[model samples]
Target: MPGERTKYAWRREILATRAQVSPAEHAVEAAALAASNTRLTGVDDVVCAYVPVRGEPGDLRMLDALREHGATVLLPVTGEPGPLSWARYEGPDSLRKARYGLLEPTTETLGPATVAEAATILVPALAVDRRGVRLGRGAGYYDRTLGAARADVRLIAVVRDNELVDRLPEEPHDRRMGWALTPDGGLRQLGRDLPVSPE
Candidate 1:
């Protein structure tokens, strides 16, 4: 298993070398593209976050698409060591700068119970392998937050096409993704099997 220190180093190296587009532009375009995809269905209530793209993760285009489709959107707020607090997202105007330069909703604060109602969750990941293992920024936030979700809830990871690789180092706490969304490739299911670690 990969150690936490190695995971952090790998994430830093990947972020340092990855090509990124403008957050604002990517957000708008990605949202439009995702909205056009037919696979993203039954998403009534969604739990997502506006992360800093390029330097952070993919744009919040997915969130915008969800909002445009009349689905209720929620943003995660940092809570105790392992959990996340959620707030109802109204729009761009309803957000304010929060920890880690993340733009989060400032409206009514909701707990894990409220987030559990979301039919789909858009998670931010550093990289996702074809086998569905997601490598995040070494943060266990999504892994913890997703514990509240129903077993059947769709967990999609938003990433660049190149970020979806054939393999990546994984650890026990690392959660798997059901689907991956990219600008070029709309939405593709990562399938259900976890990849075997390289010996």
Candidate 2:
């Protein structure tokens, strides 16, 4: 199994792979992902989600689909490299270009603790292992934010089907995903019971 040093290598490899995905493939995957949202959370649930940037797994329509399903959606507001603040996602028209080229909601800013209001949180990951270890883009945003969420909240990492691997380097501060949502695979429950240490 790969260790901490290999994590950066994994990030580079995964990102390069994602960058090669054609627009046609991305559209198909985005449509499929939007269709699978209902299986991940129920109506009336507060969902903490993010807008896909840099060829990530989802599109804005995924957020709209959640709203159409009767759930209130919240988008992250990037601040000074800490727990993310959120704002209600009204629609595509409600978003404004923010830091790091991210689109954020134009509504009032909700505090970091607001993540606890979500019943499900759609996390962005470069890849996730069967054991629920998530590899992020080296930024500690989700790491800091997830610590403030409700313990029972569904932490689902959204990735491509191929991004779901057998194992990933794990750190003590890393928050494990309870589930993974892939375009082709839909929603899959991860094996949290699996041992964290590498064999």
| Cα RMSD (angstroms) for every candidate in the order listed | 5.7, 4.7
Query: What 10-residue stretch in candidate 1 is worst by lDDT?
Result: 190-199
| Candidate 1 lDDT over residue span 12-129, tens digit each | 7668656455658556656545554334654464645444444544445556666777677778887666768888778778888877667878897877676577777778887788
Q: How far in Å is the alpha carbon of 164 misplaced in model 2?
A: 0.1
Compute the lDDT for candidate 1.
0.68
Any runs in candidate 2 off by more than 4 Å, and if so which?
1-5, 192-199
Error of 1 at 47 (Å): 4.3
TM-score of 1: 0.80
Model 2 lDDT at residue 163: 97
Residue 137 of model 2, lDDT score: 95
lDDT of 1 at 61: 55
